[model samples]
Target: MEQTEITEILNRPYARELLGRDLTRLAYVAADGTPRAVPIAFTWNGAQIVLCTTRNSPKLPSLRRNPQVALTIDTEVHPPKILLIRGRAELDDVDGIPEEYLQMNGSYRMSAEQRVEWEAEVRSLYDGMVRIVITPTWVKLIDFETTLPSAVEELVRQRAERQNA
Candidate 1:
C-alpha cells in the first residue's frame, strides 16, 4: 500500500481505536521455519508499535532471525473491528526498566500496592529488557460493517453480477 493509503487507514477513528487496544497478536516466522503467533502487550506511538519482553523471551530469537512480522489488533464482539499491520521489528536492549514496558503494563487494572509489587517483581527478575519496535509498512483497517475483507467484497460483486445476468 502507498504511504498515503496506510496513513489514512491508521488515522481512521476505528483504526486508532483498535490500535489502542492493549493486547495484540504478533505473528512471525520462527527460527525453525515455522509460523508463530503470540498475544503480547503493546503501545502505539503514533507511527510505530512498541512491545517489550524479557531478554530471554523465546520470541526474541525468532524475531531476530526474522524481523518481518504482522500484528492483528481486533475486538471480540460481533462485527469486529480489526487493524492489521505489517512491519519490521527493530530490537533495542535497555538497561533497567523500559518505559514502553511500563506503558504497556499500565492498562492492566491493578491497585496502587499491587502495581508497586508487580513493578518490583519485574525489576528483580530481569536486569534488562528488549524493546521491539515495529514501523508499519502496511496497515488495513476493517470494521466489518463499513469495510469487509477483499475476498468477501469480490464475492458480493460476483453474486450481484449473476443476479443481473
Candidate 2:
C-alpha cells in the first residue's frame, strides 16, 4: 500500500485505540521456516512500534535473520476493531529495562506496594534488553464502519448489484 494510505488508516481513531493497547500479536517466520505469532506488550511511538525482551531472547536471532513481520492489534467484542501492520524489525541493545516495557504493563492490576516490589524485581533481574523496533510500512484498519472483512465486502457488492438489477 502507498505510504499515504497507510498513514491515513493508522491515524483513524479506532487504529489509535488499538495501538495504545498493551498487547499485540506479533507474527514472524521462525528458524524452522514456520510462521509464529505471539502476544507481546508493545509501545507505539507515532512512527514505530517498540517491544522489549530479555537480552538472550530466542526471537532476537530469528528477527536478525529475517526482519519482516506482521502485527495485529484488535478488540474482543462485537464488531471488533482490528488494526493490521506490516514492518521490518530493527534490533537495538539497551542497557537496563526499557521504560516502554514498564509503561506498557502499567494497566496490570497491582497495589502500590506490589508495584514497587515488581519494579525492584525487574530492575535487579535483567542486566539489559533488546528493543524490537518496527516502523510500519503498511497498515490497515478494519473498523466495520469504513472497512469490512473481504468476505463481507464482496457480499455487500453482490447485494448492491442485485438491488440495481
State the C-alpha lDDT per candidate.
Answer: 0.92, 0.91
Show where candidate 1 strays beyond 4 Å: none
lDDT against true structure, model 1: 0.92
Q: Clashing residue pairs in candidate 1, if any?
A: none
lDDT of 1 at 15: 92
**TM-scores, in order shown?**
0.96, 0.94
State the local distance difference test value for candidate 2.
Answer: 0.91
| Model 2 alpha-carbon drift over 4 Å, by segment | none
The clash count for each model shown is: 0, 0
lDDT of 2 by residue, 110-164 (tens): 9999999999999999999988999999887889888998889999999999999
